[model samples]
Target: MANAASGMAVHDECKLKFLELKTKRTHRFIVFKIEEKQKQVIVEKVGDPTRSYEDFTASLPADECRYAVYDFDFVTEENCQKSRIFFIAWSPDTSRVRSKMIYASSKDRFKRELDGIQVDLQATDPTEMGLDVIKSRAS
Candidate 1:
């Protein structure tokens, strides 16, 4: 596929890496960055995120980090109870400072937005940022 705005073909080799989300089930997160001027996409892994919201909040810088609980979920499957929470943290004007933490469930929650862009603020989220999904099962 091509980026219509730049008339540039989005290459397959651009995919970089994957991150295994430390959720109840087998979940993974992928990252990608597209530089239209550079004609390149960089991919990478996110690793296991902090399972506790408190630890995550405590680690962030008070003045520089912005946080939000995008949404929450109560999962009941096969006698297993798990809570999936969607959230985000970003630094407004800083480099390498944006994150959209989400979960995978087969249900709808609600609609949300950040920085003028619609985000997946639901359990069974349907959203993507840039070319991150180009090399994943979601793609």
Candidate 2:
């Protein structure tokens, strides 16, 4: 589907992979990027189910804007195991203004395609979406 505001169509694989992650736990996270040439949002990477959160963070480019979804599992204060699906908007400070604008404009529509996200995070640096922040949000 395409968003009128951003004029970006989300690649079919993006939603398909997200379904596998959300329902089958086939992946720990999925990273997406906007293909300026194609005017489409495409899946850039998929973290294996056993991958750590650090691996997910590392998959992102240092000077780019991307969208990602992470399946976070944690033990709660009540001693229960829980999971939260996070929609992350990653726009590092070093990215170009045009790239940032494209991602910012397309984020909501892209997120809406992934129906099960439980948390929304906007991160400009590692500190913003660090494990500590995720842990806090999970609880």
- Highest lDDT among the candidates is held by which one? 2
Q: Model 1 — TM-score against the truth?
A: 0.30
**Highest TM-score: which candidate?**
2
- Candidate 1 lDDT over 1-139, as tens digits, reads 4433333343343221211232232222322333436543333223233343333334334333222332122334465554433444333233333222111110112112112212332211213311232112111
**How accurate locally, in lDDT, is each candidate?**
0.29, 0.94
Q: In candidate 2, which residue ranges exceed 4 Å CA deviation?
A: none
| Model 2 vs. true fold: TM | 0.98
Model 2 error, position 114 (Å): 0.6
Candidate 1 off by > 4 Å: 7-27, 37-40, 48-91, 95-139
Candidate 2, residues 6-120, lDDT tens digits: the string is: 9999999999999999999999999999999999999999999899999999999999999999999999889999999999999999999999999999998988888999999
Error of 2 at 37 (Å): 0.8
* Cα lDDT, model 1, residue 88: 41
Q: In every candidate, how many clashes are there? A: 1, 0
Residue 82 of model 1 has an lDDT of: 43
* Model 1: lowest-lDDT 10 consecutive positions: 102-111
